[model samples]
Target: MPPARPPSRTPPDGPPSAPLRALVSWALYDWANSGFAALVQTFVFAAYFARAVAGNETLGTAWWGNMMGVAGLVIGLGGPVLGAVADHTGRRKPWLAVFTTLCIAATALLWFVRPDPAFVLPALVLAGIGTIGSEYAMIFYNSMLPDLAERTRIGRWSGWGWGLGYAGGLVLLVLALYGLVRAPGWFGIPHHDALNVRAVMPLTALWYLVFCLPLFLFTPDTPSARVPLSRAVAGAAARLRGSLRDLRNHRHIALFLLARMFYNDGLTTMFAFGGIYAAATFGMDSSEVIVFGIGLNVTAGLGAAAFAWLDDRLGSRRTILLSLMGLVVPGTAILLVKSKTLFWIFGLAIGIFVGPVQASSRSWLAHAAPAEVRTEMFGLMALSGKLTSFLGPFLVGWLTLATNSQRLGMSAVIGLLAVGLAGMLFVPEATAHGREQDRA
Candidate 1:
């Protein structure tokens, strides 16, 4: 069905509207905290958590997947409801502050995770808490996009944010590799204690807290009326219900989200398991993994920057569609290679496409959602991406358990990419009449 005309709410805030300092400050959050994502979630700690904590490669991989599965369940269900609450409260900064503290504290605390079986569950739980803090915080962070820059430039801003995140991750990974390579005890800590790996947690926490101040101190926020907490909850619930009821009327938004839900599952699964899969499949130690991570981050940073203009010129839908198509081919080819050389080549392909898929998806959401409900819609956007977020992880865990082959387990992501691409074909172009006016 053709979507009914959307109601009015979005007001354009173009480049002239948002100062460059505020724009950089806004984007810097992506740059600041991505070290946690690269080090903990994607590379060093995930591998360490699985191999060192869980005690066996196969079981550790499964447990790691399951841990993230649990995090996904929490993030998927909570993001929308919380987003609705934020929309009504008109207090994005306060919530961002709370979650920022939560994430930083949680990351720094990972220094204490001992290499014992008893530590696994608690470690996973802590990681889950950090994941929630970062992911939940982004519900508010992302909602600010529509108001930060005009429609024509949203993609550029989104892409740069993503690019900066990759760059941040890359820089941290390089530092980490240098530290590890110089000596296991390079920081005056003994190698016997495994402190080298654990040391990064505290450092990332420090890095994130330091660089994130600009956005907290500088960027402006939406004005909202004060409502009692109890009343706000009731209002948010009603708004969420209204959004659900109105989905059919906003069919393209619904489909766009649905497409994202599937592709994001694949994207997230690749990230969650990429380190473990590489380590298990290729016998890559910490130093090698860090190098691999740095390579991917470099390509991803460059790719996101390159695609930002493409997203604006070609439209968000086509840009995302192209990126997803790019994913399928590389994702399959990775399965065929075992050497570091071949893996790097194919892995970089994954890197190049992944950024465009993410940046354009955000751009599309910013373009497609109704203004009044943009925050709420982005929340649902998080919900959609995360709701089935477990399916891919659980499958990777379960398949690896059953088959004892991480290669076969990794293949699960390609199907999701293909499915999402097919779904994207059904979404209407973002330039529909009412949305077009919002861009102006």
Candidate 2:
């Protein structure tokens, strides 16, 4: 094992009580980007692609799975390196801005994807680009957590961000459903060639671009390290190598990352396929899936907000364990029930757990990672969440094709979730003071 490095007593940027405006601005970025997750990735566009673009639900599902698998691989491989480079350079916002623009542009261009089978590759490519943008942007965004709030309040802020994200998804879904998809010729958008569905693409892009401004304007960013770009790039490899070596002395974080790797993959698979499965298995249309998505978002937002206190009080580990149990039970039940009504019940129940699992995981890492290498650690966090992420989607897509059963394909999530839960059992609870002791 490598010799343990001394702990960093470096305080977070800003006072313990960070300004409310900065905090809210930081949180709203979550709300902004969720437009993409809600409309493009989950409800509106995903269903449309499967049902309309590919002209075959099964083929579209498989293709979408493959596309996401590739995106995950890219994100996993690039995140740590980019994070190390950013740490050397000492600013995250510029990187965030670049990727955010990429996502917005890709989302806006999705408007050109018509209801023709010929557009399948274009649609997948655009969505893949957008997904990559959103995820890479998140590495920097999540790294800012420790700087935005003190350890005592990190859970609350993380939860608030997630809750707001879900709320944003809910609101966007409603607007897309009632104003765009369900409405006939709203704002002069014609019903011809599925233009109404395509219109949601631009709307999502506009929403993200508009709401993301506050973070750039109001949220405080890390001070520049003044390292030249060339120098930062040159040193990134060495820094990343050292960061990986240092992990040997931080077994708790390593274990937690491993546990997160499996559970997050389960979550990613669920997000990618939830709408596809609903439509393919239940014969629901795009509009119906949007309504279902709205309800799920409502429950998820409330659960995240409510659990913010629990994260701090019960500790991040317990909170995550409870949330995982909540997910595994209802998630399993949803697969068994043939009735759509039961699916709704179980699906909504699953949503309640989703927010806590994500929020607490962020808080857990915030409390655990040493301050000096925080961004690099978050990059590793992204790697853990994404490295094997392709496996979940690939398995689902493969099984869906091989067995011709959406139900059986989705069962892949259950095993992943169960494995994550068992892994969590061995990880010690993380706290702000615990981090101090690790450094000692």
Candidate 3:
């Protein structure tokens, strides 16, 4: 076996001189997957899967939620191990390619999931597997960010990615809405037929595959470590054991992870449930839901673009704190308002904060971590976020199921945000870019 390199104490030099293509490629993952989130998670698939594809609509949502929760657990538990392999092997692109193809193929196979009750379990299982693959791939992608943007400018670049992703999602959702949802008559299909919704599944697969091409073509792969795959796997297992032991040694980072876990739970819950609430409370039909999804994406894109500079200039910590507060207030307000007008108002509020939270959290972790261990750091970040990601959906599902009230379930989100904010407050300023060394 080759000698293990000493843990890198200093960050590699200030970010790369020019990593524009790398930045674009990193953002493209977001772009590629946003279609899945928008069309499958938000609008078309969930509706179709539950109402048309499952034996029971209400029960299917619960099962779908369970599948998502299981996917998150798999990702959270497995991410660090895979990321360590990437760190040791010193190649991220090949792994990315493998997972990306997995996601694309799984999404494409959804084309077969017609209005058959027997297909529910199998379809959700495929989707869960895709979710796991896409999420695991993201760990490697996030680890590359520090190489692509300067220390102070990372947040801006991250925001750029968030904007690009939303843009891609918006484009495809528009196509699905206009071409399939609105014009079924031209295709000699009924307006609310299963075929109309079925069309979106394959289109989402195509969208994800097409947009992912830029990243594969442009982004340079991390250097290979010259280790065989088997040895790399063994080394990664050893290092992960050591890293878990070392976790207690890094108290501040541990605390930060815990905090992020809870807050991210709130943020994720909002994403998972926001549309359901609108549809349930205000009675938004499919077209209105599509329009709402479009508006959210547009506003979210603008919010990311607008806040990118603010994140860099002010620092990631403040940006996250501000975003958490912004999210909390408006999110709670959604429950109070009875009218659809007010729901849109609250949704716009959500759009404003959601982009920054998503973008700045990434920058914040990059700033906090030592350079050589960036992949490990990002992997842990993904793990923490994913582990907690299940809490929101589980909580929402349970509460909604028990109370038959969306409003009651949403209250839990407020508590989650508060805990995340408080935990962040205790995190050292250095981690938040309060010190000059951190800025470097």
Candidate 4:
């Protein structure tokens, strides 16, 4: 047998260490970048992009929907290829830097998008680039887990990072809501002026830039493999080709990825459209939408905090299963509720589960993957998550367009969730269990 793997490079002592700091820095990337997900991608800009900028409500929604679908496709297809490159090169941070910088630059460009149909196409493209870049960057960051947390504490630590990310998103939401969203009149401008929305984009770009400092400064980079960059890329390409061919060989992993794809599609659809469903159904204004965003962020943070302990106590799979059950309730309620009050009530249920599910999923991966191949597996996870992203939105958008009823669009979400819930049962009960068996 091959010699036993070297004792993990992780420090063998108490919590405080260079590795812990590095992990925190990695987590902070999520903290910093979440603002884009919360304010720009989901709520405020989604409305602005769909209704205001596109100028044709139906076409705007369809256009944005298509952009997301295309992005999902690209990331789904390309993730594993790049992921293997990181593994072969032993250079996760550099990849993270390249993608994160692209995200930051694209986010900066969002400032130039005025509320006009002429700007819609470029805006959608840049937004897609930013979305794909940020998410792919996250793959490398997550692969750092083995170098940081002890196995037993992975769930709690990962949960804390997710909670911290929600908190970051919350802070940005409050700033957007109170500083820009509430002020309507700023520097001699009306509150409802379209330019007010434009102003928030620059701030988001700045937020991403500022908060990413910790990772670059505090975290130690992974040791680079001796391969030159060109050779690394070539090696990565060949390995990627082989991995795809060998996919069927990793049956349990492939099965888990399929389940993740199904459930994540549902989760993503709810997040992407929940606010729109509220607005279309209850006639919510921008201010109400802002409030809803803030509320969800708050609940999501709390949920992450609560589930951190639960994840450790019960295991990642159990936490995820419970969280999915929670999501199903709110997800179903959206179709049934006619009033804004009930929508928020149900939304609270969704917010409660969102954090735990996300945190546990990451933790589960940490437990499941071998250190040498963690980056590749995490990249594959990203691919699976993005695969059906297009389908869910396309299905919802098409259904909504055909029926001209937002309720019907949301009703479609329930089917995705139910499928996801069923799929969850098939994933292993504890990713750690699989790891232990491998060690045996």
Candidate 5:
């Protein structure tokens, strides 16, 4: 198609299967930072921000959504450009390291965000930094899919990564529940002080640092290109424009990213607000929310492991289609159900499908991306995902504030998911077997 390009990275030369050590190391990166996802984004900090910081559940939820929307906007704008630079330089690890450090540092700084209205602006700023950093780092991590597994096996590996991430999240959630929520004063931090909750921020940062080490040490990334940063950016922009002009050959991939963008926006909005949703809607406390997070993580971990195998067998596109539909049913159900028990049930459904949807989406792109531009393509994928990313959260915020009904506000996600599902009808699966045949 395009000219033959060099490998994205100078990974070890071997058989089609990646070495066990390398694979595990790669997957552990997911494990490393999941604490941030569960603790900061989904479970603890988000709820705390809404209730404790913002001072009112409804307004707090709206503010939290607005903060995430802003971060998504910046990420959407910058992800592709940064990804192109990485591809051109042939060095993803350095950029990843920089962003990971930012994520960890910003997350740690969140420990200082207190209940005063004076702290809300600073808290939002730090949270936005962490969110954008985490998101940008993932583009490079996701690009590794092409290097880590052969086309036939990428889905399973992607699933393995996600499952382990959820497992990690579950472990951290349990620990936080034990040390902070359940016991209240187990760590010598008074319950009234709420240091128990704030302390978890630094711990999550440390956990991310420790687990991420294996990847930095063991997983070899591309060697740096000698090109200057300015030239790399210019070159990347030119290539992207050329690719856009050649959309006929890339139509299916284009559709998939477009579909992924909308669906992921809905999914992100659901996740960003889930903890706040439960707290406001059901009056669930910290302990109950932690339990919910644990259960969902457990279900998602198991589902990720199971669906990974299914992805290869069913075809990545089919697997993703099933996962998207799976999300739609429960996502809508959340709007209907009032009981905490029913919310838990539907939340588990969301968990079951979320892993597969993510894993297969990546594998689908990895299958089609030329080796030369893997990082760039994944960045574009990230871009698409972040482009309308603000829409779901923004809509949720607006409706929640206007109608003063959080549940009714969440219904907005269903519309996004349904449109994405419709878009999939045009996304023809470009089979891996055909590519293998071409290679022969």
Candidate 6:
């Protein structure tokens, strides 16, 4: 077992301010990474890969699902180990930098993927690598949250970061739409062979590279443990084992993690398929998908920012339940809706709940994790979110293939969300510094 630690100096309920510059810089990492999520994973490139590279939406969607499933599996298995390693080494920024750079490089290399069937394999490979990079980097980035914010304010800061991230994605989607895809010739880029759409890859890479600098340059990292690399690696397994055993004592957190596993998988599926579903079902084209994406981001950003205070006031557990309920309603409506107009309305409504669910989940973990094992716990958090994440995509892809209906494939998400909501009902709210709030 790791040695017992002294009590934290920060009060459990106070609102001491975090350093504004560091806080913003840390949050801006979210902004920086949003370029990849918006452009590559969620909106532009995913649509392009489906319709252009794979030569049809159906095959492309299945392939994309497989790729995401593989990536999720890798992330789920590796995140906790990496977090354990980082916890042992005691510096997270270096790991964050390495993974962020990998993502940027992989994203930039995506510029080589032409809109050809021959390019499909390369596209999936690169996108999967980039996904792995982005998700791994997030483990370290998330673990930094408790160190930055006071106990009572973690939710607000988390929401602010997610809101900023959505705004960043929204802006990038607009730029890709109008600046490149819509008018590539104006910038001396040719429109032939879908090169205009392909250009967004490098553009996203550049955006990530430029915007990610602030976090590396300004955000404070946890102090180094001064443990040698060999020692850290050697001890990681033991530490992870210890952390798992310790988790048994925190039943509420464990239950919360179990609940999160389902809902987060649903969210992951929603993100992976949202654009594809729109294009495939509604017969919307790439430009329409981007427009749809922008609208979703607008609502998601608003919801996250607006719900920031409510997370702290009403408590993270209640905030999550509310968001989950909000998601379920619109999410089901989306599956039933045949009208493109109605799809847009329900999709946008779903987005309003997406960010709050994600942001509050992060804050909840940050607020409840013991200081000694915090990073490892965040890793476990990633594990919870990703471990069965493959199931969501796999089921969607399998069902889509079986039923030949995107709608039916997507109905799996609602089931997953419902399971998570049920599980959450049993979890008590976790409060400052690993304490559970009293049920009475």
Name the better of 2 and 3 by TM-score.
Answer: 2
Clashes of each: 0, 0, 0, 2, 0, 0
Q: What lDDT tens digits, residue by residue, belong to model 4 across residues 50-132?
A: 77788865666667777878888888888887887778777678888888888888887887888888899889988999988
RMSD of each: 3.5, 2.6, 3.0, 3.4, 3.0, 1.9
lDDT of 3 by residue, 43-107 (tens): 66766675667755446656666777778888888888888888877878888888878887887
| Model 5 Cα lDDT, one tens digit per residue, 54-77 | 888888888888999999999998
Runs of candidate 6 exceeding 4 Å displacement = 1-16, 184-186, 438-440
Q: Estimate each model's TM-score.
A: 0.95, 0.96, 0.91, 0.92, 0.94, 0.96
Q: Against the true structure, whose lDDT is highest?
A: 2
Q: Candidate 4: what lDDT?
A: 0.77
Using lDDT as the measure, name the better of candidate 5 and candidate 6: 6
* lDDT by residue (tens digit), candidate 6, 22-128: 99999999999988988899889998999989998888988999999999999999999899888878889999999999999999999999989999999999999
**For model 2, what is the C-alpha lDDT against the true structure?**
0.89
lDDT (tens digit, per residue) of candidate 2 on 1-440: 32233233347432375699999999999999998988888888998999999998888889999999999999999999888877777789999999999999999999999999999989999999999999999999998878878788989999999999999999999888888888663576778899999999999999999999999999988888788988787677777787887788888898899999999999999999999999989888888999999999999999999999999899899999999999999999989999999999999999999999999999898888877677888999999999998999899999999999999999999989999999998888886643723322
TM-score quality measure for candidate 2: 0.96
Model 4 TM-score (2 dp) = 0.92
Residues forming the 10-long window of minimal summed lDDT in candidate 5: 431-440
- Higher-TM-score candidate of 4 and 5: 5
Give the Cα error of residue 259 in candidate 2, in Å.
Answer: 0.6
Candidate 3, position 358, lDDT: 85
**Residue 257 lDDT in candidate 6:** 91
